[model samples]
Target: MSAENGTPETPAGSTPPTGPRPEPIRFFGTSWVGHDHGYTARRIALAAGSLAAAAVACLVLCLAYQGLQIADIGSFVTLLVVVMFAVCSALAFRHTWAGFSSRPDPDRQASLRGLLTIGFIGSLLAYAFRCLIEAPGEKLHRTEYEAARARHEKRTTRRSGNPKKRRRP
Candidate 1:
C-alpha cells in the first residue's frame, strides 16, 4: 500500500471495462402508435370500427335482455348501459384513430394524413351518433372534442380580430 499510494488504476491509457448500455424500454401499445403501412392503417380502421360496433352491439344486447324478461321500459337501464358503452367505445376508437392518423406515411409516396383524417372524422361521427341515441339530452363527455374545438375557436377569434390592410401589390 505504501509503494503505490494505495489507489488502483486502469491499464495505461485504457479505460475501465463497462457493461453494454441498457436498451430503451418501449411502452406497451405506444411503440406502434405511429405506423403508416396500408395494412396497419386498415387494421386501425377496423379496430375503431369494431369499437363503435361493439357499443351498438352492447345496446342491442341490453335491449334483448330487457325484452326477454318482459321488463318495463321505464325500469330498463338500457340508456345508462348504452351511454357507458358508448363512452368507453369512443375512447378506444380515439386511441386507434390517433395512432394511425398521427403517423407519417412510411413510403412518402403520398400523404396518408388525409385517409387518417377521414377515418378519424368518420369514427367520431359514428361514436357521436351512438352516444346521442343513448343520451339525447345529456351533454357529450366533453373529453373528446372540447379542447381541440376550444383551441381552434380561440385561434380563429384571434385571427378574426386582426385588421387586413388593402394589398398594395
Candidate 2:
C-alpha cells in the first residue's frame, strides 16, 4: 500500500500504473465518463431520431397491412402475419435490452438473427429507450473497465520486503 494515498504503489524499475482506459460506447465515445463533449445533447438527438424512425416504419407497416386487407387475403392469414410480427418484435426488444447489460451468447444471437431482422423496429425502439436513460451498453463496459483497472493495480503493486535483509530459505 502507498503511504501517500493509501493506494498500492508500482514496483521500482517498472512503469507507473496508468488507470485503465474506458471502452467507448456506440455514439457516446468516452464522453460518457464525464458527460462532456455534448454527451447529453447527443443522447437527446439519438433518442428523438430513433423514435421518429420507428414511427415512420410503423406507418409503412400499417400501409402494407392495409394493402393485404384490400387484397381480400383471408382474415386468418392476415391475423397470423400480424401475430408473427408482434411476437418477433417483442422477442427482439427483450434480447436487445438484455444485451446492453451483459455479453450475449454468440450462438443464441446467431439463432435470433432472423427474428431480429424481422423485428428491427423493436431494436430501434430499444435503442431509443436506452438513450433516454443512459448510453446503451454503458453499464457493461463500465463493469469490464473497472475489473481491468483492479487487475492492473493488483499486478503492479510492489510487495513489502527488502531482499537483502531476508534470510535465505
Best by lDDT: 2
lDDT of 1 by residue, 25-114 (tens): 111121122222232444455446646765676566668767845765554476665455455556545544443324434664245444
lDDT of each: 0.43, 0.86
Error of 2 at 14 (Å): 17
Candidate 1 ranges with C-alpha deviation above 4 Å: 1-69, 73-76, 101-169
Q: Best by TM-score, which number?
A: 2
Clashing pairs in 2: none
Q: What is the TM-score of each candidate against the true structure?
A: 0.24, 0.83
lDDT of 1: 0.43
Cα error of candidate 2 at position 124, Å: 1.0
Give the CA lDDT, 0 to 100, for residue 12 in model 1: 73
Q: Model 2, 65-169: lDDT tens per residue?
A: 999999998999999989988988899899999999999999999999999998988998999999998888888988898899899888889677887888977
Q: How many collisions between residues are there in candidate 2?
A: 0
